[model samples]
Target: MRGFDTILVVDWSAAEGVRRAERDSIWIGAVRDGMAEKPRPMPTRREAETWLADRIGSEIAAGRRVMAAFDFPFGYPAGFAEAVTGASDPLRLWDWLAERIEDDARGRNNRFEVAADLNRLFPGTGPFWGKPHRDRFPDIPYHGRSRDGHGMAEKRACEVASGASSSVWQLFFNPTVGSQALMGLPMLSRLRRIEGLAVWPFEPVDDAPAVLAEIWPGLIEQAVRGREGIRDMQQVARLAWAFSRLSTAELTDMMDVDAPEEGWILGAGHGPRLTELAMTAPDPMADPPPAARAPLEPPPLSNDCFALPPGVHWTPVDEALDLLRARLSPVAGRETVPAVGADGRILAADAVARRANPPGANSAVDGYGFAHEATGAGPQHLPLIAGRAAAGAPLAGAVPRGQAVRILTGALIPEGVDTVVLEEDTRTDGTAIAFNGPVKRGANTRRAGEDVDAGAVLLPAGHALRPADLALLAATGVAEVEVFRRLRVGVLSTGDELGAPGVDPDPAVTYDANRPMLLALAARWGHEPVDLGHCADDRDALRAVLDGAGTDVIVTSGGASAGDEDHVSALLGETGSLAAWRIALKPGRPLALGIWKGRPVFGVPGNPVAAFTCALIFARPALSLLAGGGWRAPLAMTVPAGFAKRKKAGRREFLRARLRDGRAEVFASEGSGRISGLAWAEGFVELPDGPAEIAPGDPVRFLPYAGFGL
Candidate 1:
């Protein structure tokens, strides 16, 4: 009723297995206030569920009412639910499907078999139809037309009103949404159980944290039919934008429905409203909403922002990440810098293309340019024009009939000339040129906006600029960008026995590796490294360094545990802000997370290897948010295991590993004292917090060192 603080539109995929970021995969587009996040392509329903669930929880925690729509009917034909589940309530159908339908990340399911079982229970030919094969499905029909006497309405009342052509009975083929519903309903059932989450039409949604709804993107076909890129992506983006722009009263009317048995689409009877709203969707190329440019300084962390969730003995990787994403707000300040100087800086707002690349139609080769039609059915010859079009120059006038002009790459094609022939393909004399017949039309001609369209969004907010990205920004005529200031990270290492890198240590002591390594890691992540310097394990001394740190956040090694001499953590605990997550990760512990003087402090373990691993795996993402860049999850790939191991649940392990024969080989020793192992391995093989008896061919997640940037 409040028009939702956030709107997410999903185009669910019905693919049987994990898919890539391509067509036929799930795509989600979202709008918050007046800004839109880049569409996300999900490879599996499992991932989509996790992402959707987490986002809902995160939004609710932030006190934002969310409207999440999936492109599938929420209910079947009116009587179908009663006939199948013996209940008129649409939720009953969702529960029944949740219990009967089985789906997995690998894209295998028993939907067809489940449908076959349902058909045998119903009278006559039954309602469900369509599958991947031509082979007969004794109970399920190949086509909806082949079925009869199902004793159920072919389409729901809302479907007919909304002009949604594909009925729930058509499981596949002809732009059908049935399979998506069958696959998505189980996830919906899981979501319905979330606290403060409600289903539209079927459940009253007053002041709910989030509302789940069935949306037919085709309700406003004109809005998405002509957009570029993937159709599914465009549909969700424009639709979400349109929905987010609606007024409270308008949204109320759309939601004022009573189709408990046949759940209504959000905008089923408001087609004109949808069309009208689509006409005014925000332009991508234009400057985003002012809110998109976050304030130069971020607000302080909310109460209990760093407090760990209770009832968890060991924090898992996913829980840690979700907590970071939900609670940690960016603390970095903002600035506008020249595009060239914006290297490695996270965008404070989206950077749009000021102009298209290859601003005009130009020649792509140094050859003859003329009307493609001039090349008749046979080998043709034409007189060379007096003028030439070279790179950075243009021909004065259109080429005359039966004439061709010499054109070099990057030169604008003259009027009336739409094609070019490579010099090697043509026999050119001093005054004329001859080429073969049947030349491809518009060949070797670079059209305007071929690489990038004018006003297109070049980079989304929070994207860190890379060297290659600068080329794109420059090509698109972006002069300067709004970026977050580099975070000032201070590193403090304790223990009088430790010495600096170049200095020799005492007989019983080793040179301090954690401090320098942590500082360098912070620098590599585009932060301003501040050396807090080493100090002995005096709580008063540590407190003094932290008080005068004057940095955005601080990182400390050693003395983080709860032992008597663990001053770093003791100081934080005294301040009532310490949360030793005691995370269940190898080489990770007492991830001393706390806020001191309004700045986050990370106190890692003493062991060099443990400090490095914990900093990379746990502190990296948290620090990213503290720096005003959004949480960044390290990229990981699945590779076969080159070694065998038996592990118990409760602890996640990250083994220093390298890729060999396309498999991940862990370091020789699992010992945390082996600091040399960190340098020996190229990446880390992460084991989940589940009992795993891994063998040689088993798959494991490999996180490359390069993926972390730092």
Candidate 2:
């Protein structure tokens, strides 16, 4: 599909009303054409609205598609939407919340009161729980055990697939998505009126210019962690990059998902596949020399190339990557190119020296050359010889013993001249040169094969060529080298609300951001990046772009999860090729995976932060293998925790953080919508699958940006 041209990832906050906390507030990140934009910190819900409106308006003005993904739940479980709004359309719930949510600029709102009232809609504790322990209400409870008679499922299907995600009924504590949903749904309701904006799985996925979806940052957080800045900022940036690298086909597959009522997190289930591919992939170094390999082999083509594991839920991030490695392989062809043009290319075979470096013995200094003598360490002199030996012009006759000849650097050593003195150490005379030393035999002269022997291994296969490597190739008489062709990784942003950066600004639209950042990232990592541009939400338009892309893979932002029977969803259904890979992680659950026209496509949330994180954690390594660079596993280091934190069990989480005083300090908020936290973070502090209560000075694992090649 044409996919999304821009990605905007948001991390939402619910710190207001009864309590006015201000740690991790609203954060918005934008990625245009594979390039990440500066994250914006929204201090208030009102300011966040204006910021979104203006940015989205600009994107719409420029005719780009935008996918704006919020970290909070886009909708409650199936029955809750209907119960609250008396309508099947969850968007109606947005309207309901908008009418009742009383919010202001100073982080004050009546969310608790509204939630309490909503809880009263049904008999007995109608499911709103996790309120503050000290604050009590007629129906709301501080603990789930205190509630009763709630008919709806406590956790949505997406949450169940996420393994250990908190129930939506839980409004506070333990990384629940409910509190933010209470605070953010109203904003979504207001923004719904923006031109071309459509709620995913609630409207035609491809019919609109802008698509709104839910996102979870945790999926990629585990693979590509950070701790240099606030945890929130880094995840969004990383997530944005991840989505921007997906192919049009991949995006289409993601858009073909079936989550209708309860929303799904973007890029969740796909992490395992990426991890698998990176971990189990055959080493690029194992490839035979280009001359010894068979002809180019094509990748497998099938409707189910991206099939998600059936009946599997709660997959860890590492497991997801492992699956991907099992399913994918190098997709590029081998070709020969001049050694000089091979820089930045992945070698298809080991490189061997054709000839020894320095070819033969030569002079190492510009001075008089003479036979060495076993004399004492004192002044010595030799009579002048016949002619000078300059580089590319060696003296024709051999030098006699006790006689000397002037030799320039790189000049071939004259026969019988075993040593040469430095010009600085010799006294120049008309017929003779003098130096104070007992010159050692064979000194100041290079010997044959001194640097490298003929037919020696110069470089291993799969090694990415660099300038220094070229020097070795040149010295070894290697004029041509075989390398794998660059992988064509493409990106597209969906939604009508996206436009070029300088369009007329509105408070509801966003400018293009994801495409630019992703393309640059691919290029930096030595892959051929293709900009597929923006496509409207219409499935036909997206299909047209997909057919013309001619890329090996495409990444899409937005439209991963569409409304009930959305056009894009139907399109995928008709092809019977779309699958949702649901992973067990916070911030991410079901990721889009699919195939179209033999090209692999993956869809990522338009949220810049989530998209970027997914790209690094999953897409980067996958592309590395596809581009014949082999699988890439990001490096991580053990570090100390600078702050205290309590994390729930059954899921892994990567918190954006910065290293301070040799310890990891996590972001103030866990909201995935907060892109500012990502910007502030340098790496992530990875928490294990089991529950953990970390205190100050405790051990932790930190994944830096450099580790992921960021």
Residue runs of model 1 more than 4 Å from their true location after superposition: 1-153, 156-214, 217-288, 291-293, 310-312, 501-505
Q: Write model 2 residue lDDT over 1-710, tens digit each, in one string.
A: 35676788888888863222323757676666444555555656776787687666645543346788888888777788888778777777888899999888567888889988998787777588877764677568877788888787877776667564666677878676778898889999989898668887667776466788887776665644534556676556556656666777876676676777777766556766433322332222232223444457555457776676677756788777776655666678888899997889987765889999888889898888887862337888778876899999989999998788889999988887878888888897869887898778777899777777676557645567889999999999999998888889889888877787777588577877778878888888898999999877788898888789899888887777666423344456567887666556655554576777776777766677677777777788788877766566666788888999898898887788889989999899988778788789997787888999999999998999777777
Flag regions of model 2 displaced more than 4 Å: 1-293, 301-305, 373-380, 423-430, 433-438, 496-504, 562-576
lDDT of 1 at 453: 72
Q: What is the TM-score of each candidate against the true structure?
A: 0.69, 0.55
Predicted model with the maximum lDDT = 1
Instruction: Score each candidate by Cα lDDT.
Output: 0.82, 0.74
lDDT of 2: 0.74
Clashing pairs in model 1?
Answer: 16-107, 17-107, 285-455
The local distance difference test score of model 1 is: 0.82
